[model samples]
Target: MAETDFDLGVVTAPSGVLVLGMASWIDHWSQLGQPLSERASAVASIGGGHVQDWMCELVAVPAADDKALMVRAGTTTSPFDGGPTIAVLEIDLGLPWAGTAGNEPIILGDLPVDRCGMVLGDAVALDSWTGDSHPSTDGLADVTYWGGYAEAAHLQYGGELIPQHGSHVRGWLDLPPDDAEKIVDALKAWEGDQQGRGVMVAVDEHTDFHRFNRASWTHPLRIGAIEVAGCPVLGINWDNGDHSMRHRGERRFGQVYPVTLQPSPEGQTMMRWTIPPHAPVCDGPD
Candidate 1:
């Protein structure tokens, strides 16, 4: 990886600086059947919580030919709290390879192998922060309870709380398993393609949906090619927990149908689908 320049955003919440990476890498370690406490211990040994100069450095572990487990400076909202986005040292696990072709494998410079513990630590911290409780180690359990839910609700509700009086029904388009898999694979391939741009799932305008009391229209949901260990589905905004919903009165539900991936005029990869009638519904307080 020829030292590609990355924009390191300013550090806002230093204490809250976190470590996170692709779901593929996390699944790799978890599949090894390591105990959660042991995983957390390994991470702590590698400087998981320690910070320096507004950045945390760790050794890169190779995942494949073009990819390595490296730390890149970035920022994201703290899973512990929704507000005040914090700095993050993202682990690049090399899946859906972010680099272009014919480049040397991205490698961390002059770092001792012993420092690889930091990578493990970051991964453990991420699991803890998300409160997945996969291994449920002491001090790691319930570190943050469903922060994404609140964030998702806020994104859809347009407020900190879901309105007290309204009918809320989330709409989802049922895609055949094979079609969903193909779409996810295509999105990942596009992410790796040199000409590929950001992709999204464009909710069919003809579909009826609502969030709360309002009509609650939404922008296209961005597609993240990476898998989220928490939710392994291929649905729209699966990782972010932002699914489409509609007002009950506007509901013109349809049946499960296949979808095809198409490119928008804006050069973005997209898929359009009608909402299925059988959706999870939540009625607001009376």
Candidate 2:
């Protein structure tokens, strides 16, 4: 099995840069493709993380000798630096730590264990291929699910079929057909007019966050659960058949109206992102 037990001492030498084991090599996520020795130089360009840099390397024991196993071997005698003294980094690189295959299925090997790409094994993390992810990082919102698939009442825990997702929700996004223009127009209108508030929509938060500590090792990233049938039914994004019951309120089938936003003339900020009568998509149990 992959190991993730690193003993590196994490500290920020200066600024807000997080450092570990006295390593000048800032482990920035962008530097995930760089060599261990040169990674530190990339820190200035990439951002910092828990141990300061968000990206680092993990190597197996070279000689299997007591010193080598403990990373006591130096660069001259082993494939590591700082001899055994620096070898303690294995604690952070492997096993149940931030850069091992522990989080991802360990069947595939060769690549680093990380969430941005590999999880201990070589296979890519859950949604890295999805275009919705962060461009370079592939991470989704810290907590979300299908963007706006659940009715306002179902956003909290124990509302409806939230149990199907097991626990918490995040990562899925069901955008309107005209996602671009609508968002822009709404923003513009929100800036132009001041008026009474429209409506409020809230989705219960059932979150189960996984600490990013494995392959595809960039930062704290999660694949979060997906709710296939238990989402809310929005006329703008779904059909009448997709709903669990007859949704015959304000928003009818095939309507493409966006949630409007406008500032109140009475000195109040009004914001909303939904159509009316947005009911449960899968109103029934899973």
Candidate 3:
């Protein structure tokens, strides 16, 4: 096919930064001991749901480095059943189109699954520091853990911490085979609109509907769409163990649902991060 038009709409911003920003909001709520519901009322006043853009330069070893990967993500949180659920953090990286165009986005360092068990505030605190302050590797690890547990809990109970002391119950989303096909087609359209860019969505699952205490990856599907709901069982950067694994048959027979979109206030908007002036890793061969 002729050069595909990879136009995902100006690539407004990276979803990692946007998701972190949203996570920070939850962090703020968690610190306040609020109910922590993922309802529209919680984020509706914010710019609908802020679509974030993030970019970073990765150095080879320590001091200065070259560009590794470029990424963009988006998400929104709302209350479901008796708790909260987030339909957020859609990721796109490693697209041949973006690389050839000289537009690479860095995936946020992975957050470990173990570390995700910590309070949201702790995770944000760890992520606040830049490479100048802490080893980039460590920071990535922290988030990987955070992403894992956060996703695990969300998919299991539609909330962050499984109701404080109560057991956790996550639901797996198994879209109909036809619906799955439709989602893939939607993503293809999105890629075409996004300058031939590809997209991935990861959702978490609960280990048991009755047990409500453990969780696992039900099914992590790669679909073609602007956005998908539920939690991310598996993270974009899985090498770090920042993600969870889904069950074998969940994708084939679980129930699927639509994610509700919240309204954003006029003045509200998502956050965006530009490449720092002094990137240690840029213009280098990967």
Candidate 4:
């Protein structure tokens, strides 16, 4: 395809550029004799008990000097709700593209940035391919902590407890007697007279806390027990973070948990977790 025919824009990262177009573009490129190879594939739960399969492929786009790596991703099962199926391609900045006479190769500073891109495992891997900073494993660690917290809630409250919010939810997880004792000690050592000191106890890479606190600006956490499809679960009663002008924060929850350290039918490394039956109704946190 000619440079003018390409619908492309740079993303937030200087080295990261995106090829925005329909999903059919992948087939069209392949028909044009471009080399395509499967990069990575996986099934992940987005939210609300829904799951989707994701696949990423590496496309070799010919350039004047060398080949540019264009990573494309799309869902195999279906597109995300209310979102169209789109292809995202990340190009290698080091490679030179065929340009008009006397025109320089596209640089990050030369083009407008487009932040819209499908988030896929291979897209993340593109950062590594381009020698950019790799995505952090902190998100996986946080999910483990949340699984432990949800399990603790179930044990203590005597019902099928679901995570009402994301990582921001603060509460003690019910742990074994020995582990619980250790958590208590940790809490004692970490707790202070400070109004909102965040205290956490990681028991064998899982969360087992003795006390949880909310920041002064946020609303207090309230516990409410409810039923979902005849199964009882713990619920949250609080504001949706829109009461104050300063409360502009995004909330995300991990709807899956890892069954084991290895891959399995349950999930590759993450297992499914319960979600609230309906969006939490709430009053402003006071």
Clash number by candidate, in order: 10, 51, 57, 1
Off by over 4 Å in 3: 1-33, 38-42, 46-286
- Encode model 1's per-residue lDDT on 195-285: one tens digit a residue: 5542332222111111100112221111111122321111111112111221122212332222222233343222222222223556978
Model 4, 1-286: lDDT tens digits are: 1111122221221212222111212223233442121111111111001111222222111111222332212211111221211211233323332333444222211111111111211222222221012232221112112332444433433332224333333333444546545544544354233553433433322211101111111212222222212222222222333211111221112221111111123221211111112233478789
Higher-TM-score candidate of 1 and 4: 1
Best by lDDT: 1
Model 4 spans with C-alpha error above 4 angstroms: 1-57, 60-80, 88-140, 144-286
TM-score of 3: 0.19
Query: Which run of 10 residues does model 4 get worst, by summed lDDT?
Result: 207-216
* Model 4 residue-pair collision total: 1
Candidate 2 lDDT over 1-286, as tens digits, reads 1113222121111121111211112123334553332332233123211112343432111111111111111111111221111111111111122212333212111111122211110001111111122222322222222223334323432122322212333322233334423433332333211453222222211211122211112211111222112211000111222222322222224432222222223322221122233233566776
Q: What is the lDDT of residue 27 in candidate 3?
A: 24
What is the TM-score of each predicted model, taking all chains together? 0.20, 0.20, 0.19, 0.19
Checking candidate 1 for backbone clashes, the offending pairs are 1-104, 1-105, 1-106, 43-121, 209-245, 209-246, 209-247, 210-245, 210-246, 210-247
**Local accuracy of candidate 3 as per-residue lDDT tens digits, 1-286:** 1111121121111222122222112223333442222221233223223221221111010100122222232322111222111223322221222111333232223211111221111111222222122232211111001232345333433422222123332222333444444444443344322345433332222111111112212212111111112212122211111112211121133311112211122321122222111112258776
The alpha-carbon lDDT assigned to residue 18 of candidate 3 equals: 20
Pick the winner on lDDT between candidates 1 and 4: 1
